[model samples]
Target: MLSGKTLVVAAGIFLLGLVSFGEAIMGGSEAAAHSRPYMASIQAVEGDAMKHECGGFAVADQWLMTAVHCLPAGPNGRKVVLGVHSLSQAEDTKQTFDILELHNHPQFNPDNYDNDIALIKLDRPFNSTEAVKAVAFLRAGGVNPDTNAEVETAGWGSLDNLGNRPDALHEASMGVVSSTRCGRSDYFGRKFTGNMICAHKLCPDPCDGPHRIVDSCDGDSGGPLLYNGVAVGITSNGGKKCGQVKKPGIYTIISHYTEWIDGVMGLQPDA
Candidate 1:
């Protein structure tokens, strides 16, 4: 139920004169090195260089999750870089892997951005290390966080409206916004779906207040939204400009897709 207005994809390449709907981290601080072991950087091979495209996180030994929009053309030139805190440094803990397969949600709708989740299979299982590991995720029938619950997200996306990206990963704390509130006419309205979750720092009036807002912006697509040490959502989309009041970053609820994820990963369902 996206607005009739044309929408541009975020966290990746953008065409001129298009407003981006996806987002990255704004008003966040640099994350401690190797603190977020599950974080993954989805990079695209641009000629001889591998450029950062989106954020993702490991869910299992060889599987990571991201937004389907992050790999619109499939995984032809995509690679997953794990255990990387700084993109500029040659970290000894970095693990790079070729994408073995990509499993996008069968019912994904690009127009409305619904069911935006996708899983990437690595060519080989990850080697356990201090800076490389998988994180826990929400299971089917698990309790979802309540409104105002504190959650966190991290990425290497632009830090502000001018598109200032960072070499090191950054993280921010935000509060969950109820679907009812997020779906208000002034907010996302019909574009916000049940399968989606939203989070942001509270700002009564962005235009009038001096408060610094924290949110995901361009280049943060496909990242994890962690709550209570578990990944409950996947970064999907947001306002044209990040950190806007009443325009929280939208995410694909992981609990809603556990069955599909289990089937694709060949894991037994939780009893």
Candidate 2:
């Protein structure tokens, strides 16, 4: 498939969601530490770097994980800058590392977005911080997360659909939806095989936040999903509009891709 040079949403039974035919991404949470999603920066780019591309998280001391679509290639020498409060420039004290290699799931199908996950291996280990820490990556093992469970999403996308991708990270809260309401039919593949999950507010008219924090939109793809401080999923793709009741937000189930991530990283995803 031709790279659209960009990507990342929604769906309906409830009239709010994470449906694929709609967009299906997920997010991670960190608290006042996570009022919004923060970004990692590249120390210095040769040229055309301002294009800077999509934002990702440091899942490991040396590794930065992001959506496969954001980086079609370039595992070697790729820079993973952490604790960046903004995108303006690189500074000291922010943990930095070099990308020694990259591992994007081999079956990744940009069209259907199957196996939509990637792992970045850093050249060396860096320090961790409360503002920026390693999120727990779970095995999922195809187990359904309990409904009404609180989940959080973090990204650098537009607070609103009509805006630009924020230079810094932003966050929002959602609840895991019951599989029954997601329109499961024999035709939709095995219940959890689609490798996607839905999480949202029980009611979606949407609540206002103090800093005025909003949700995932264009440019928020490949962000993290946090449940009780564990990183469980990544932003896959959601539809165009957001913060509505009818459109359910979809996420690439992280637990479902343990083997692939581990294989690429040369470490066991479950270990």
Candidate 3:
């Protein structure tokens, strides 16, 4: 489970350095309505308002996959927004569900971001539609994608490390980074566990200081890191600053935890 102490410390630094923050699709463009149908917004409801806390994707009729860190510390009215591209708009394509349960990984180590995955069970199942669908998973024994392969992610996180959240859903393209490079001492160091996957942009960004690369920023955590329309990773953590070229965003490797996910979802292991 995510430790409150760890988050408090990280949040303090995030406020001070103006560094790149949480898992938001920092460098991406606006995603079209229902184009990424599997995307879901995890929201914490306070009174009449719903605050977006993290991103997630539907995997079953009533189940969603997200990062454990996104789970609220205390009881709250948790809900999910689905099939909507604009946060403010109540379009016909939009759907909402109350979260009935949260299953955080038993061994999730918030201190080092190990096993930063979780599942959300909805009060009711959603009907399949043009704007709402479950995402595909990487097949059993499927070939692992090579490092530097192009992949996409979508979210409604901050436009920049310290910027306000966008009203529209955003999408960005990034490249997979090898475990060797991601584990470098100068980078994530010992924190980059093998269970995690890292990814970032291959090009440079002048806006993020020096030659920093584009990446997922705050608010994008729990979102899907996709390749060829299949979910391969879940957004987890990132560098000290958002979009630091060398500090690519880290994600929970979905393929590595398929069995556990299947167990939680009551699905066949070979499904």
Please report the candidate that would top TM-score against the real structure: 1
Which pairs of residues collide in model 3? 20-241, 20-242, 22-217, 22-218, 23-220, 23-221, 24-217, 24-220, 213-245
Range of the 10 consecutive residues with the lowest summed lDDT in candidate 3: 203-212
TM-score of 3: 0.85
Candidate 1 vs candidate 2: the lDDT winner is: 1
Better by lDDT, candidate 3 or 1: 1
Which ranges in model 1 have alpha carbons more than 4 Å from their true place?
A: 1-26, 203-209
Lowest summed lDDT across 10 adjacent residues in model 1 is found at 15-24
Q: Could you give candidate 2's per-residue lDDT for residues 88-150 as a string of tens digits?
A: 555454665777777777877777565678877777876665455666667756444677787
Error of 1 at 193 (Å): 0.7
Q: Return whichever of 2 and 3 wins on TM-score.
A: 3
Using all chains and alpha carbons, the TM-scores for the candidates as numbered come to 0.87, 0.70, 0.85
Root-mean-square deviation of every model: 8.7, 10.0, 8.8
Residues 191-210 of candidate 1 have per-residue lDDT tens digits of: 88899999988543332223
Stretches of candidate 3 off by over 4 Å are 1-26, 72-75, 204-212
Candidate 2 yields a Cα-based lDDT of: 0.59
Q: How does candidate 2 fare on TM-score?
A: 0.70
Top lDDT model: 1
Clashes of 3: 9
